[model samples]
Target: MGFLGSVCRCSGALLAIPIAVIVAVMVETPTVTKLEGGPTFEAPADEVPQDATEASKEGPAAPRMGSGSMFDRIAFVYDSTNKWMSLGLDQHWRSTLVKDCLQLQPEDKVLDLATGTADVSILVGQQLRTLGAATDSVLGVDPSSEMLRRGVAKVESSGLDHVVRLVKGDAQDLTSVQGIDAAGTVADPSAGAATGSIDKISMSFGIRNVPDRPKALAEMRRVMRKKDSSRVCILELSLPSGETFLSKVARGFITHVVPLIGWVATMGSGGDEYDYLERSILRFPKPMEFAAELGRAGLPVETITSFAYGAVNLYMAKPEFIGASRTLAALQSLVRQRSVELLTLAMLREKVGKRVDAADVDFSAFGCLHFWIEDRGFGSEVNNLVSAAIACEEFGLHCVVEDEVWNSGRLHTYLQAEPLILRRCPDEGTSRHRPLEVRRDRRVATPGWFAVCKHAKGVSFAKKSKFMRRVWRYTTETRKRIDRLNEELRLPPKYIALQVRRGDKVAGNRKESVQITGMDFAREAQKHLSSSCSVVVVCTDDLTAAEEVGRALRSLGSPAEVRWRSRAEVPANLRNGHWQASYNSLTAKQRIEMTHEFLADVEVLRCAEVCLCTFSSNVGRLVALLRDQRTVSLDITEWTND
Candidate 1:
């Protein structure tokens, strides 16, 4: 009538002898056998050779029956036994874990522990392939050689040998394995020794078998890339606890029918192993209790999903590390909680360090010059901020822009490092902690409020060079993305960079002073289009202007090719006076993409032999500052004059 009753009736003593003998014969058969004349069968990496030709030539040897816990004794029948017992739902469950739960990315590296027959590992490779990731990204590790041997055969049969790998590994002691160091860092020749490299870890019906789950979990956390991005998924059998009828049926199947079927499948030699599974299921902690254990093991449990009326549970977690991002988020929370007055006082104390003479002390706060560009564009804002930082260096005050600004602006995005800010303050929150003051002129100065003053004149060339050097050194991620873009573009060896300023510059107020046309930019570019120039790169906010310059140059019969972001590539929001509005309206991801485009354009301009542009554009100024190439400013008057 029910599932367990049917299994019990079918698995009686009558069929045991023949099934046992078949399983015995299967277990005794060597996965790899010596050939008569063909090349010797050598295991590739941790693979067990399973050539069909070798199997036909050799007779069944001896069954590897050892201890009660030995998996090699049942490796040949493991998948079939489980499939029969679970009614062919084991594969579906594993696939659900990979597709629904893991959601792996293209660049992710997976670690599948207790990878019995590499079923879960192969599934992970399949899922990654769907995400446009390479198949060779998954590494399946297990302790049983026989299991890995069968896994190798399945991998070869499926044509997934290039994508997935099987390795002999103990989950509790993964540090001993090659490519995985004592530090738990995964090293691969293709991916390199990426710190905290492993992206997702999946253990299916495996954690219950591991003697040291806590250590195994710690190992998972150690190899994971980022606490915020990486996940650990554990799927295991559990005893049904609910009072529902289905729960009772599931319980009966696990407690009685599973062991009986396993016993018949192994032909009594390995039947006791099935009994251990039932006992282990009953011994495993409840979902909540297991979640607590996961937390104790240094992983923050995210979700626990139960299937088959609570007979199986999948536990998901991520590493819980107090990284720099978390610290900054906490600091931001603290800033939001406290009043501005208290924050100012805390910052003042942090800046002064020692007691200050209140009378003669100039109360000045160093920060990004956000208030300097009330009527100016983005470039003016950045130029002022850079000047302010230089002035802060000259005046011996710590630049506080790093602490206060949270916007996705040029200064915050481009600068490699930020000035240190005061992390803590006194608990009293009163003037009693303040230094004594003598009578004198007192004023609280905001760094951003002060225009680039006479003090900025003292900023030496060496200091400017040091600041620019640090600011220009891009982060590793940014550099990689830019390099990929460069490869995709395939620019010629020699090129002339042109920065054409139009849009908001020639529209609205002071249009007369900033008036410039596409022909104007084209004429300026023509001056540098010599026989040696291999290409022309035009960076412009206005798509029409860029196209006009391209046509003008083409009509002149210039030998060099013109390269620029196609009109389709540039988002419509970034064109004309709507650039700022569109930028503000963009989602976080879109904003990041826009920023990358801007930075990439700057990098392209930096690589040019000669730069031609109006000084009014910040792109031109930044390009001139970064390179020693001859720059011709089309605008004769100073663009900084307001």
Candidate 2:
């Protein structure tokens, strides 16, 4: 009665169907089309039907894993064999794949590769249809035409005839498939790769069969959509690779016992040839190795759900950030070309701490503008980072960072590129890659200080916008944090943002803190705020200053609804990881917490209708970079940030 129950029943019925004939019947539910300008989709001889003499002439491809004719032999019995070998747990593994892919949108299309009799294909359709996702044609590609032929019938019988379609193709190179486009959109079957592509991919129990595993993975990366949630769910049969007792037993079952079960299932129907199944399973890479392979292909696995004591693994992956390859290739080329000796913190600690002179370092592999973010005020650090990144672009030098210094060495963070932290000891056997030591003037900001370290002729701003738009784009975590901050502040459709600075700012020069700074912010807000703009959000380090601003706004006879965040509201159960610089009286934990608080506050400031603050402070100057002319510095009569 339930939809999933209906799917299981349909799968059961299809599994029981026998391949009594290769018919001339045209199935209305499924469509089959051949890929043009590529290899023949037919399987090698040893695996094809006896009647197919032409394909048999091609001889059997030595790699049994990729042998389509082999799968064709077992096509009708494949699902049943899986049920027996997996102890009826094959469905559970696919259900996990479905669960991971539930983030799909209504308009997104899913590709099912190695769709034997369309089990995973139909199941995905059933699940997606339940969610009202478009299942009009969930395309399934396979290497063996026989496997696809049977799979087409299964799709029709499952009541997903309107949803699933099967075609013969190679996963190693989808480009070989006819009518499929390479431009990342699913197009008409008549077009080649120029037309379009699929959004998500699900390949169940077939990755092991692909002889060129990395190539197949790279093909997956090339065709699928690159949205943040666009994923590839690959269910692979694997050997149990653990030291646990249960793992050992599962390992034994796969190696010593599964082959016998498979042979017995064949009932002497080419039983000796079926030994290839055991070989394929044994030759399959371990879970970790496969995950690394996935990484190398630019599809980083997000989760690996293991089943049957690790006999199977469900890999869910997301595309690596776009242009990451280009960024790195560009950096690698530059580093090698310029002979810049890039050094990491470990190398630094080994040689010198805090600061090192360039004259003391040896010349080597690459020349890079080592981007640095110091433990200064949060505003100052980001300004330094952005400034240096742009500077790297301006000079056409390799733009990279030291590993320990990137995002302050926090894991689980995100970046546009792989961050390209160039670490080369070249030959610890002969070369110690000491850092490009700069005589840093501690008071100055980075890449500026870094520029001086490089002894640059000067700096330019031409590359600033380009670097910010493409290279220095914010991570999803950052966007999430900003959104959270906006929601908590309850930002209005129209409201001016006011910031009051105290602490070090008050002691710096003629600057004021506490109530005076708040008064300055409030007065500036009045200049930008008409009666029509009657809402103002105040951000401040000292609550006492915020209190002053609210009072000043009211005393100015402005009808603005004043809102400000308390120190207690700053930290949320958001990002699990963050980089904090140790300073003042705060403990390490408190320091990190405060960093989170500061980040949230600045994001709220960035979202303001108009900003009012002193440009003399780094926070005020940062507002100009984020929102440009929409900000005003109360200390300066003119609008200039200088």
Candidate 3:
């Protein structure tokens, strides 16, 4: 099914989001307080661990740290208190969060959502600078105006004004973070970083403060770049999930003594908010529960790590590049829904035709294997070839494309990809004239989806791209022809492109493929377009829709001469998603010529600033793999829980 109908699926799941870390100004060291039968901790004289017995009587419904006023009172000593409370480990935790969890790249644009006193923001800026990031890459957001006030002063004092920016915004909602979009640079800082703009998000010591944690989690996932290396790293204070002696001791210390440390560090000026820290830890969901919560929020946890006797946890979630592929939350829903059929296969893995498992094979019995070749679009044919490649590799079986497939029956004759491994069942060859018993081997007909599901692991984007390029390799003449077309169209060296997939619908009573309609690929493309986007190329079946995209791009009049190939045209029958069907009825020479034209279009689609296309189309998916596994899939998953 195409994603045009999936709008509700995504919108129902997403609520516009939060990353919030509140920071406190550091203070001088204070003397440690002596506890009975234990090491001394520098805590308030008026409070002790014994007082925590009453805290147990306190309900788990601790007040959520929504606004920053409560933290504003403790902001003065937040840093120093954390250092002392964690026995000088808090600094290391933050550093690890930045260096390890974030894994910041030189080009990454970061959002430290709950930046208090701008500690994380400052760290991110420094790391980004070290990486030689030329862009003003870090945006610090927090709701506490007072905390932001101090953070601004720190950011300026640290001489990172060109790198880090602090804005007043809530972790549960980012729209309030001034104007911070992709173009809303330091010069125009009011625009909040737009959705799919941020590469990394860091929330250090902020999750406890968020009442609507799922909302914040979903928001972070929303704002993050929908590509590989995108991450949301949250370092939260957690309770020990063990009953060991050290675990018990650490638990008691964190629950009872940490609050008093806040009180002592701030000299009772901190008010009762320090006690909320203990309550936040208590009210925090258990580690597994929180992990589940994250999955449900659409930020599927890729890594969960515990530090310091499980008192602190770093929860790392990364959004998949594709349409929320096999997320833990989605799998769990399936498990719950189909517990009885847990052993049953998904309907998508339908048996296309015959099956061939090599392990059980005695291939010596037959000389040639039967492969079900069909008349389908070039995308579909390539998909089956990919499937066959994987199946052969996994089964240790040699494949031969013998039959007339891809409609014209001699489809393989037109294709230039002479795979070293796959043998051609040639029409003129002696092998073609062999006896029936000498030719007939085992049959192999693995479905396209089945192959995808089975051979998913270890096939990285790089590997997949290399494989597809090999399968669709161009000849010298083909390259020359494409270049000639590109020059005639006056396409730029590097510019944005759109792949508007009208989906696969065949002619007559032939069971039609998925139909795609009423999509907004241009909307997604517009988000990434700018004055720097000098040229845009639209690759689509429907030139009518391409006309809309061309108008939209040209409407943003710029000094950088915008150019688009608007005179592009395709026959109505071909444009209606039946190119393969029409080609089958054509002569062999016409089929070859049509193949060349299609390849040129694919080559253009293969290279773009961004491939704004639907995941519903096979060609669009193929384009995604080639675009370094990055593109606006335009899947409507954001509107639904899927």
Each candidate: what lDDT?
A: 0.59, 0.56, 0.58
Q: Which stretches of candidate 3 lie over 4 Å from their true place?
A: 1-67, 179-189, 321-642
Name the better of 1 and 3 by lDDT: 1
Per-residue accuracy of model 1 over 1-642 as CA lDDT, tens digit each: 699887887777659854553354233221111101111111122122121111122224311111113676788689999987776667877887898678788988888988878899889887776787875698887767677777877777777777777766666656644333222344442332234878888999987766555556667877788746788888888886644445566788889989999999989977767886777677676554466566545565656666766677777777666542244445656665334324443543443322221113232432212222221234545444555556555554444332222234434444464552111122112333221111100112222232343333345544554565555677677887667655555677678887777654465222323656666767777777777776788777677667877888777766667777653445786764324534645675665666666677777888888877667666666566667567777885332321
* Every model's TM-score: 0.39, 0.43, 0.42
Sort order, TM-score high to low: 2, 3, 1
Report the Cα lDDT for residue 544, model 1. 69
Best by lDDT: 1
Cα miss at 274, model 2 (Å)? Answer: 3.6
Better of 1 and 3 by TM-score: 3
- Superior candidate under TM-score, 2 versus 3: 2
Query: Per-residue lDDT for 7-48 in model 3, tens only?
Result: 766664443210010111122111111101111111222222
